[model samples]
Target: MKFKNRRNECVTTSDGREIWASRSVTVVVCIVLVCEDQPYILVNQRGTGVPDCQGLWNLPCGYLDYDETTTEAAMREVWEECGVNSLELLQGADCEFFSAPWDISSTPHDARQNVTIHHGLHAHVDRLPAVSNAHNEPNETADIRWLPLAQADTLEFAFNHRARIAKYLSHLERVAWIRY
Candidate 1:
C-alpha cells in the first residue's frame, strides 16, 4: 500500500499516537462496490499536501463531518474520496471497533491511547453502464482506478486499505455463495 499527500490524510505520532492535522475531526471511509454481473471496487489516490498518506492508493474514503450519520457519512465519503455520487451502504463491518492508523490530523476521542479501525461497506445500486471505471481529477486525486478483486489484491495500497478491501471481499464472497 502506497501513500500520497491529501487534505483528508490522517496524522499520527511516530510511536503510533493518533493525531489529526485538524482538531476534533471524524474520518469516515467506505469500501464502495459496483456489484453488477461482476464485483469491482472503487479506489482513489490522495493528492499532495495532506497530513497523512498524501500519495497512495486507497479505497473510496474520507473524514466524517461534525453532524453526519454513519450511513450518510459513508455515501459522502464515496463521493468526495472518488466521485461516486450515488451509492447505498449495504452492511457495516464490525471487525474493528475504531478505525486505526488514524489518517488526517484529527484523532479519535481516545485514538492516542487505543488503536482500532472500523469502516462501512457501501455498494452501488446502479450499474456503471460502462466498464468498471473512474476518473482522477487533479487537485484531490491524481487518478482513479477500478480494479477487480483478483487484480485488486495485487495492488499496493496505503495504510490498511488492502486489508479492509480483502475483508470486504471475503464477506461478499460468503454472502454470494450463501445466496446460491
Candidate 2:
C-alpha cells in the first residue's frame, strides 16, 4: 500500500478511442483466510506493479485463464497471488458475492466481449501458511498481516474489495441479507 492512491482510478486501454465509461475485462477470483490460532484474517499488500488495481489492498486474487472453472480459477488465483500450493488446506463452500456487467464501455468499439468472467469470492481456514505469499521482491509484498477482524474495515482496499469481503463473511454467517 505504499503507492499513491488515484481517487477515481479508472483503468482504461485505448487503441485510440475517446469515450469515457468504465469496464471490467477479467473476472477476479479472490479469497480470505481465517487463521485458527489468531482470530485474524490474512490479507496481502498487493504489489503496486500488478496490472489494474495496482497499489490497492485486495484479497489474494488473479484473473481466470482460458477454460478454467470457477473453482479452478479461484484456486489458481490463490496460488498465483499468495503462493499457496494446495486447495486441500481449506475446507468450505461459503462466500458473499455480487457482480455487475464487466464493462468495456471505456474501451474502443472493438472492446466487445462475448465471454463474461464472473467475479468470484472464496474463503477458507488455513491450517498452515504457505509459500504462495512469499516473493523475492519486496515490491510484490512488503509485508503480510493477520489483521484483526474487529478493525478489518479501517484498512483501505481497491474496487469493491471491502464490500466483497464483507458480503462473503455475511454469507458464511448465514445472515438475512442474502434473501434479498
Candidate 3:
C-alpha cells in the first residue's frame, strides 16, 4: 500500500505494520541555565486550561514550526517563553529522540504515533531574570521560574522532565571541575 503522510511525504509499505509513519513529529527544546556558581533550570508552570499536566512545572518547550530547523525552534521558544534573546547553546547538546512508543504520555493529544526530538542547551546569564507570559498562548503558561537543580529534583515534573533534568544535572557534575 502507498499513501502520503501528514507532512505530505509519500510512503510505500507492503504490510500494515508501517502505518505509524503517518504520525506527526514535534521538536522540543529545553534550556538548563547555571547562574551565580549554582546550577539552575528554567521551568514553566502549565496553566489550568492546558490539555495535560496543568499546574505542573516543566522546562521551557514548544513544538517546531513548519520549515524551521531544530536550533531555530529552540531559540524561538526561549525568546517567546522567557523573553531572553541572548542564549548560547551548550557545546554538545545534540538532539535526543523520544517517542510515544517508549512512553505513551509523551504523545500529543491528537497524534496516533508522536515523536519528540528534545534538544537541551545551556543559557548564558548572570542571574535569573523576570519572565513574561505576554507572548505565551492563552493559558499556556501560568508562571516561570528558575529552580535550583537540587530543589528541582524534589518537585513533581510533567512528562519525563524529571529524568531529563537529572541527566543534565549529572552532566554538570561531571564537568564542574573543568568549568571552574
Say which candidate scores most in TM-score. 3
TM-score, cand. 3 vs. native: 0.66
Off by over 4 Å in 2: 1-38, 91-128, 134-142, 175-180
Q: Write the per-residue lDDT of candidate 3 for residues 1-180, one digit (tens) a residue.
A: 986444634555776444334455554445556677686677788888689989888876767677977667666776676665524344323322121111212444542355565655555456666677777778888888777766886767886688866665555446443131
1 versus 3: better lDDT goes to: 3
The per-residue C-alpha lDDT of model 1 at residue 129 equals 22
Which lDDT value does model 1 have at 1? 85
Candidate 2 backbone collisions, by pair:
23-103, 24-103, 82-132, 82-133, 83-132, 84-132, 96-168
- TM-scores, all models, native as reference: 0.56, 0.55, 0.66
The global C-alpha lDDT for each of the candidates, from Candidate 1 onward, is 0.52, 0.50, 0.61
Model 1 alpha-carbon drift over 4 Å, by segment: 1-36, 88-138, 174-180
lDDT of 3: 0.61
Worst ten in a row by lDDT for model 2: 99-108
Model 2 alpha-carbon miss at residue 160, Å: 1.6
Candidate 1 to native Cα RMSD, angstroms: 10.5
- The list of candidate 3 runs beyond 4 A from truth reads 1-21, 86-112, 171-180
